[model samples]
Target: MHRTVFNHGIKLLKPTQRCIPVAVLPTRQSLLLYISNHSLQNRNVSIKTELSGTNVAQPKDANNVAHKQEAPWDIDFTNIVEAYKSKSNYEIFRAAMVFQLCTIGFLVEHGMTISKYMKKVTGKWLFKKSMNMSFYGHFVAGENQDEIRGVVDKLSAHGVGAILDYAVEEDLSEEKAEKLEMDSCKSNVTPEYETMDRYQPHREFSDRRKKVVSARTYFYEGEAKCDDNMNIFLKCIDAVGATTDGGFAAVKLTALGRPQFLLQFSEVLSKGQKLFERFCGKEGNLVDRKFDQLRFETKAAKLGILMSRDESQKWFTWMDRDDSGYVDLLDWNEMIAKHRKFSDLFVVLNPETGDEESLLPKFTDEEEAQMKRMLIRVDALAQRALEKNVRLMIDAEQTYFQPAISRIVMEMMRKFNRKKTVIMNTYQCYLKSAEDNLCTDLALSQREGFHFGLKLVRGAYMEHERERAKQLSYDDPIQPSYEDTNRNYNKLLKIMLEHIKQGGKADVMFASHNEDSVKYALSTIHDLELTPQMQHQVYFGQLLGMCDHITFPLGQAGHRVFKYVPFGPVDEVLPYLHRRAQENRSVLSGSSLERSMLWRELRRRLFKGQIFYKPT
Candidate 1:
């Protein structure tokens, strides 16, 4: 029940019991004129909201309600982005159907994995945001903010004043973080980049296509139990000679770091591959002494001792002093021969005393230099990247060396990625703790004010990692399932986007060919309101000769896209090519978009002419 009052030629509807404003009654104009002194307290507000209509409700003519109002908000996403504006009919049709087929397959796979009720929601997600929404956004808005406020007052004057702002601004805009910067500007002798023996992107003077050339870095073989030390050494030499940035060079400590003192280094080299092969070959003990002599000479050479074949006997006599069935006694003897005490050595020098302080090595300048040279090489490599503006990606390696690699990469990031991204660390998303590590790094970047760049990949050394973990009786470092890895990978992208939004300098080279991941990242960028500069921070990447479906669409959309072109001598890059081939097999199996695209393009070519039809 309501009452109407006419005071000084003005009409107002008041609810009985309490003086509810007639303008909020939601009824058509029954009351009249201006709503005078009705405060919002004890307002007749309900959680139920209506989102339809055309005109803004106004103060009614002696009625409790105003005229019908239009919908609260609208956004024009039809023009927000154009991912396939320039694509041909065949290309467009093929691209569209590929997503559709993929959506169906994804729905079937992911649907079966979720709860029955969630299947419906997830299925809808696949159909919409996962596919349709990614393709286009319809134009939708009418009244602006000022019009909205005016209409709301009109509604209050009549009856209903319950309209919510449809275009909700996220609290994410205009984030102000403490501006972080590089501490010391070291004047590096910038290496002459143009003359470097690397593939140069055809300098696209026009805007038709932005081209990029990237260098491939291979894993290092510094670890004691590494399989390919010779290759690792060769890679290090190449990396040291690199001149500029476009692609990253990969390195591994397992391939590079040799802590022989801790016995952490692989015995493959120390034990002598020749000796192992000969012993396994059982080539008769006719040359057993010769084999022993060769092993001693080789080991002495590796240890950098000036020795000859004649000195093998003397070396063996010195090394076999204790005959403890180990060669480290020679090292201990060498330490003693050089000095009365040892300090600051990486190895535990004092076994008799558990108190480490009692066994500290007396630091000699020469010994310290020798000890640091190994780690200095790592710094030198990263510093070289920094100096030449060549991006360095410290490849994720086996868990044994991953900890040290991660630490060193973080240090490298601190020093190199201070402004631009010279050192982009790799994250193996298949690792269960990758998200945690990403968060930690992102937070560190935010606090320190340095931009962080990341090259994300699914774990490469899973077999090796698991094999070592099992052998060592430890839990595996890999995520439980592919789905888990996928989830983490996508989640990491969103977090990185948020980090970028929150005033952290960040860039990502989205290096996966997974359609779902690529779509999700694009959606994230769009939602975050990509500026031209933000586009630079976000990059889509794939290996050369792969995933053109993802790469081309993203590139066509005016976003930066990079194709990794491995350049090296046949012997040097075969391992890299083979590695990508193995990885691509997995990607192709899960999402056969690339293969499908290739077949379609081939068919299109065949149909267009008797001879090969050129691409439009």
Candidate 2:
């Protein structure tokens, strides 16, 4: 009754057995192997290897057994979720938490009183402590490595690993943060979470997790004392283990607000608030010349402001270093995004829908000066990231701050991305201009001979951006509708992959919680016949706890998957946490599959009478 298994780990199938895929199985697939006509005594067996991520079949060379790539769905998530299900009421607690998140997200997204109410209530200690154990604990890794390690191990068991999201802030330390945030109004940056002490993990525990996990890093710029803040976050990693973990690291340009006075700057800059006007020396002098020209042409149309490029591609071309035959949309949009950021470009737009647009005159001398200073700091961050052999990602801020962020990221990429893509730029596809902007970036990469590392997300500031546009009576900068945004996301992904396929160098991270987007990415790679090496250039990302169903299976199938693993004190990371809640309401609602999937998983586990763990 013994069945024969080949030396290459291919199992011999019974003559009457039909092949079934692991994806369709609610449980682990028991290797549906079928043997072909080959001499058994000759010790060579031929088996067709056409399995997909789930159960679908694809054609491949039958003999190349040593180098097989499993489809993303080959990993069974029932056991994965069940293991985490063993962790303290993980399922039911999260279900309730997600409901709360959806409610909050709906209110915030819709511009209701709940957003304001939530913010006010977050200031209370009881509310703060309660959320830390529930929502925060679910999403963020521990404030320290011990807690982080536990969560990391749990995630790895399911094939999804972690990326630490560390935000720098206005205060120098936890002591200052406590006084500045908790004691006063709401903490501009809140909570003392990361235990920054030079602590070591137990050798025993270290050895155990070494097999299970690696970590990616996120640099969230705060302000002031950037060098110090950078040192703090960078040092937190157990460098030796991280190198072995096989994930990327990051550097955030906008988060490091004031290098010298970084926190002071970031404190004011949070939520897109502007600091006081500053003197801008030479840049200001040049802007004034443009201003005079603009005023002469437009007859004081902008009401005390002037813009030379109101009707010109001349300025656009001047910024297009690659001469891609089109303006550097990144720079062009940044100008528009920044103007909107500073004083609402929507305000200056004619409600008459005249189709003429205006931009803010250049920055004040001091503001321009700050950018120079910030670049200096950004260079240091990029250099350090290079030395650490880690990838740096510049977070995409609001349009107001994005130009500076984009400028910093481009410089970092040019300087460091010469050999490999150590620096990545995040592109928000929700904006109509993003695809053209990315194309400009692609041209920059080609011209400069650098691999463009890009992170694509649907976008975060839809509500704020739209509300302001409506308030200011300008056409919104976002895509006209959600369908448009999704279309842009899928199209940009296709464009990015095609760039890599055509031998244009690129690295991309598709960060989304949407199931269709995830499937589309995998299917595109499969259809394009992107080799395994090329596929590595593409990675899938989800916020930890938001899309485990997608990330876990993808990770298990040996696909590169990353989870945004946030680590910070309760109060400090609260704003980010709140935003995640809102994002899910929008992202997870389309098909109602998010809820159905969770309920199915929960009921299955409950029926199994699995061991239950309590939520913290």
How well is each residue in 1-616 modelled by candidate 2, as lDDT tens digits? 2233323222222222221110100000111111111111122222111221111111112112212453543344344463244245464556545655565544545432343356577766665566655667676765554555566555544445455555312223334433332222222332222211111111222111111111111223334544554444344222311332223555444334332222222222221211111111123212121222232224323233233453324433433335654422343333332332322221233345533222232233444455455555555555555665556655564443444455456656777889887778889998866875577667767866988988898877666556555655555779988899999999999999888888778889898877778888888887787776677677778776665667766765657676766666665665555555554564445314555666666676678885463422
Q: After superposing candidate 2, which stretches have Cα over 4 Å from the reference?
A: 1-133, 167-228, 233-246, 258-365, 584-592, 611-616
Instruction: Give residue 454's error in model 1 in angstroms.
Output: 1.6
Looking at model 2, report the run of 10 residues with the lowest lDDT sum. 21-30
Model 1: per-residue Cα lDDT over 345-434, one tens digit each: 112212344322212123234323322444555565555545544455455644443443554465556666777776666787988768
Candidate 1 regions off by >4 Å?
1-250, 253-256, 259-371, 568-577, 584-591, 610-612
Model 1 C-alpha lDDT versus the unseen true structure: 0.40
State the lDDT at 95 in candidate 1: 46
Question: What's the lDDT for residue 550 in model 2?
Answer: 71
